[model samples]
Target: MATRAEPIRQLRLRTPTDLEAEAVRNVAGALNALLADTFALYLKTKNFHWHVSGPHFRDYHLMLDEQATQIFAMTDELAERVRKIGAPTLRSIGQIAGMQRVLDNNADYVDPDDMLAELRDDNKDFVQRMREARDLCDDSRDAATASLLETFIDQSERRVWFLYETSRRGDGTGH
Candidate 1:
């Protein structure tokens, strides 16, 4: 009897684009990293949304839920951008975890103030990363990707601002 052939495990689709191969590769890599970090942040935000408890429980919970929803919204667009640029996108959660730079919070309990502070820092860092990715798109002459990054960077900046305000003490300095 003839041996059965194994199915192809890694399939690379060729999406046509005018951009150079190296440019596509670099932008896709950056976008994928951003995508991974987005996923990580979304999960962390939802975790806090679910576990948060304090005098401001309702406000904190609602804010986290909104932020998580916004973060999750980016995933599909990011992945599609990668494909549009003639490159492959993230395949699985393992791929996301491997590429993610945003730190995960697996703690059983985190103080409400601490949670806000942590998310603030994370959002700030994410904005910086998105700026870097935007710069990469600029260098590669990828206007579409750069434009998308601009919107995401703005959204992340707003998240950072909200997080900072929410976590601030009565003192205006927030020191």
Candidate 2:
């Protein structure tokens, strides 16, 4: 029997003009940042899903799963898009921790409200970065990337709204 060598796949990026390429890089950087944000958010949501209790246990349990699911898909999508653009995707834990603007504590348990607050802040940070990405893409004449950023911003804002609403409703209602 003959041993076969490993197969190699090389991805190529379209050679956009300088300005367009800059837009792609800017968007890619922001998206890369967004991936890190999502990873942090994913852990937060998963933590809350496991440790959240009292008052809104059922609601929050399902909510974390739903919200985290969106980020999970986005994580893969963003990384692939980065690779498609000939840029490397940084998915390592240290890389993610270093790049992410979001703050999360994976070392210890936190309260339900604290979990919600942390995730809300992270989503809001994502919205801000995504808006920046959209503006950069638009200025650089890359509507496709702009559109992608818009979609992500939309969902992130909705997530922020959801968590905010939950926090608001939890106050003084004794649920």
Best by TM-score: 1
| Candidate 1: stretches off by over 4 Å | 1-12, 171-175
Error of 1 at 22 (Å): 0.2
Cα lDDT of model 2 by residue, 116-140, tens digit: 8888887887788778777877777
lDDT of 1 by residue, 90-162 (tens): 9999998899999999999999999999999999999999999999999999999999999999999999999
Give, for candidate 1, the lowest lDDT window spanning 10 residues.
2-11
lDDT of each: 0.93, 0.77
